[model samples]
Target: MTERTFDSATSGPIVLGLSLPVGSVRVQVIESLITARVVLHTDDSTGPAADAVNRARSEQNGQVFGIEVPDMPNGVIVRGDRGTVVQSVGNMSFVGGTVRINGRVVSGGMGNMPTVSPIEATVCLPAGSSFGLAGTSADAEVFGYVDRMEFRSVSGDLDADGVRQLTANTTSGDINVGRVTEQITAHSVSGDIEVRLYDGSAATLNTTSGDIEMQATGAASGHVSAHSISGDVRLAGARHLSVSADSVSSRIRR
Candidate 1:
């Protein structure tokens, strides 16, 4: 278990390659720009990610090249690509077929104002990139696909045109998704949740203590379930939608 650091003129789009132990993997992304231009925090202490890191620094032509952390652990922050972050497969194979990244936090608009840039992470599995019960609860998981997704601190002004499939949980903030995969799950504790469905997308939303606003142009069989302790629920504009507002102060405007 070792560590290393680098200082480069990092900016723009970048990819993160991570390698962990034979267990689960967790990804926790944060933004607050004070540290440096870019930072790759690891969950595991596997000496130093030499080969992969050097390669990242080399091909970084200027516009903040991508990086691959050989052993990214839980709660480890991948500080770069102030844009979109993705979850994808690796060049090699995980020693274990099981991969989980639940109980994790994925966020943008960090480090600098409007931290949400154009960063995206692709998540795919190899053959049976299967898993049993990998927890995002500070465990080391690998890239095999995602079972659940959690979101935090998504500002209303952020433009999320490339967001596909997402599962989110927010606190004192706002969330908006333009596109969706097959299913999108979300819940908020103290803010409003807004989802704008693509032409033909499906989704599901749940919240407690906040409002739910959605827009769907296409025809998809989706539903929204909202419950609150002291907030209102709102929904509007969907070809097919079913919702349950459990709070007395919930509103829906779609």
Candidate 2:
């Protein structure tokens, strides 16, 4: 249960990367003094496997967030370390200007593996930063004004709002977005997609067995293209210009 914070730049665009295996992740954009927070949890306290788990937790704990300078051209990466900090929690870093955040959750066990559910990791980023989020089997929620946003999930529901450009992919989990101002590219396998566009530029939504529903402002002049194999496509209040919808057997309503 150790916590640490890092310092970042002051101004400019920031990129965020987040990865987790099983626990939920919540990200908030605020005009604050900090960049982000990372929490790692494991069964290192009390268990027959406590010693082994504690050794692993100590090695991989604070290694979650890595920063790259101009050499790498503004980047952040999140993934598992050398099998240490897979279950421990609490690591934070602060940076400005093109911030990138990366997180990961791995599976491991000790002799007497504790039956503790992973704690949720909450991150706070600067407002209006470019962001990227990734997760597997853990639900994610993001709120902020992003210049550009990218998200990937597997069987994890995602919710976001106040984004300018969005690229998202999901499998077997729902995606809900609000107030998209520029464009959106979304893909889903068996999860539904719902988006509300205030001033849309373009949208490409694809799903295999999940429904797609989108709404644009009446004054929108953007183009919308949607495809689904066995799911419905519903569009409301979108401009009648340059719109395309396709489905195999489900209904397509505009």
Candidate 3:
């Protein structure tokens, strides 16, 4: 018998702060807009969550946006929205589990914007947080803008489209993005980097020993570049591509 519950509030903002005693479960972040609203498909029905939901509902620590009992446990998806901002603070025993952002930002709605509106979502998993991409689809629309994003200690894949600016700092994980306007800066002491740009965007990828992959060519006038300590570089289907190999051990080609 799976147990679950939902406790939500209109904080005028969405902020989820999870602090509990003992439990083994996964958390997902999701967003909704338009007619095809987003839902949190959880496996746990409403048993294990009754206590937590009721307690939280009775508390006054912070504001709650939306809740789902039988929500998806593996990942939270923000669907059919124009300008929706999703964020989380991973504090469970699993630490900073995984985050999958597979949606688009529209305009003229509760969650809609043009250009990738700035993403102030800070998933600070410090010692146990991770992020990644679960799937890819053309169904996702790109109406709004992601102003900027700052990722820290995320242990999963980082995926997006039409990103204005982005920062990834993973102590142990990988970062993969697409369509960032200004820069895609990913620094991992131990991880890999992969950036595929459909529209030209500047990028700076650095890692200790993980390989770097950059594939973006849609009238992208920005320079394509990568940097690593003990990792190799690969480039394909690029226009006006330039090669500036630095290390004797590292290889660079156009």
Candidate 4:
């Protein structure tokens, strides 16, 4: 178990970035500090998972704080100034169950690949802070308010409360947001999306084989567009809004 803390009193609404593969993250919104506690669950204490946990690095460049775990090597370039990180995946490829970077084989085969251990991270940050998460099979839960949140994942579920803006893309993972004030754009291939919207909130939720459920509150005067290919779409408590809902081979209820 490793814990790292950063003081964000002077940074003022910092941006936190995380890249974790096969893990779970729980974020709590607090007052003024940012703390990240990580634990790697593995049987082998001297293996790659342990090494990756031991060698985890936290870098802060101005208002941007990034945590890097070597176990899942995603090409991320961090720039100094105000939290600018570029993820470059053009030179990476997976062929024949092997991982390659720049045409060089990193993992030879399924047997040669490093064992994937579940990493659990508990993060505490201030309110109004923004965050970006990149994960594979990693689930995340947030307990408080955030200014903006972005997630890109494969089979990773997300549950959050009170986000001003949110953009999430996942495959086979559900997204449930409690309160959306500004805007929300969520897409899932086979996962459900449920959100509660406030006044002047805009939402665009789409799913291929999962349900879309939305509840409007307090005037609900913004635009909402929901679509599902083979799943149900339900809208409740909505008044005075432009709504476009469609479903193919499924039910659309309002």
Candidate 5:
């Protein structure tokens, strides 16, 4: 296991990013500090898995901070800057490309080696910070309040709490959020979507074959839309809002 800490007071509003192929990530918001702890969950800690964990690099460009792990020799590129962060991993290959962070080379070339083991990361950021993630089969959990949160995954579940703006996209992974204050947009193919204690003004939740459930609190007075093709749509405590709910071949209950 490896741990790193950063001072959030000097960086203003920090944007933390993580990229992993297969693992679980947990993020928590704190008062004024940032810490990241990573562990490789494998039996062979002295082999390539250990090397991957050792090679995990942390980069920062102004308020943007990120961690990049060369989990796969080929088909994985993780890069970030002050404006945006992009991370991709799988069987696809990008030839003649170099991965860089703030114009510094992280990985110059990709090898034809096998992928590494699963990694578990727990990160702590300050309040009102933003987070971005890109992964495959990496389940994520977020605690406390965040200014903005965005993630994209395949077969990885997301559980979050107290986010101002939330956007998530997943295939076959459930999405659950609590205490949203502003806006939320989520889409899943075969995973359930549930939101509780939502004071948000606008919400757009969609699923192909999964259920959609939402419960509003306080005086949420905007528009809420939920749709599912072959799953149930259940809503509660949303009397003061305009709701547009639909289901193709399933139940819609209010």
Candidate 6:
């Protein structure tokens, strides 16, 4: 296990980016933190790959943004020499004023090299920070009082709460969002989407082959547009609003 911390007094929101082969990631906000922290926990397989696995480590922490697990070797032989199975569990990195995270595991060599263990990460950030998080084939859970947020994933579910403005895009992953103050734009392909909003908040939700559910509270005048191809669309609560819902073979319940 390796841990690193960064000290920064920048007065801007932090931005984060992450790339993982197969693992789960989480990001949270801390209010009283003045610095950022990153921890990496790795477990390597025994036998001939042990030494090579030990060499497969993350890059040094950067002042601005950092990524765990150095760049994969280009040649197949070079990659094989660096161990084909190194995994990170509970790998965490903390940042302030714009940060990004990126990671990926490669599988090579003959004869069962043991499935690449799923890598998980937990990121704690300061409140009121603007962030951007991205990953592939990994579920992500993010929350905190954020000014603006952008999230992208493929084949991984996403859940977010308490954000002012949000933009999310996913493929084959469910999306659940709560309490957006300004506006939200979410798009999904073959995955369900759920959104909750207050009065005077606008949203656009679309899905294909998945359900779309929305709930608005109070006498909201927000404009909501929801569309689905072969899935159900449902809207409940709130009066005095403009809503446009569409569906092909599924019911559009209001």
Tens-digit lDDT track for model 4 on 1-254?
33334344344577888887656788888875544333334333555445556777777777788876664444432222212222333476788877676787865532343343455667777667888888766688988898899988887899998788899999999999998888899999999999966554688899999999998886667789999999999998775678999999999988
**Candidate 6 lowest-lDDT run of ten:** 73-82
Residues 53-106 of candidate 3 have per-residue lDDT tens digits of: 333322323432322122112122222232222222122122133322333222
TM agreement with the true structure for every prediction: 0.39, 0.68, 0.45, 0.76, 0.76, 0.70
lDDT of each: 0.38, 0.62, 0.41, 0.74, 0.73, 0.62
After superposition on all CA atoms, what RMSD does each candidate show versus the true structure? 15.5, 12.3, 15.9, 7.4, 9.0, 10.7
Whole-model alpha-carbon lDDT for candidate 4 = 0.74
Ordered from best to worst TM-score, the candidate numbers read 4, 5, 6, 2, 3, 1
| Model 6: per-residue Cα lDDT over 1-254, one tens digit each | 32233333343345544554444667777888555443333343432223332433333233344443332222211122223433332222324422222322323322222333334566666666665656655577776767777778777787877677888888998988777677888899999988776444788889999999877777456788899999999987744568888999999988
Show the lowest summed lDDT stretch of 10 residues, model 5: 77-86
Model 1 stretches with alpha carbons more than 4 Å out: 1-159, 198-202
Looking at model 1, report the run of 10 residues with the lowest lDDT sum: 128-137
Clashes of each: 57, 25, 41, 0, 0, 10
* Candidate 1: residue 151 Cα off by (Å): 3.3
Residue 88 local lDDT, model 4: 37
Candidate 6 regions with alpha-carbon error over 4 angstroms: 1-12, 38-42, 45-113
Give the per-residue lDDT digits (tens) of candidate 2, residues 84-177. Answer: 2223232323344221224322222122223333335566666666666665555778877777878787777878877888899989888899
| lDDT (10s digit) by residue, model 1, range 1-254 | 22244333443223323222111223222232222222333333332222323333323444323333333323232323232222221222222443333522233312221211111222222221111111111122222233233343322111233244555554444555555545666665665666655433445556566666666554555565555566665555553656454566544344
The digit string of per-residue lDDT tens for model 5 on 1-254 reads: 33333333343468877776656788888776544333334433555545666677777777777777565443433221111112343333444586443444446443432334455677777777888877767778998888998888887888998788899999988999987888999999999999987888899999999999988887676999999999999988887789999999999988
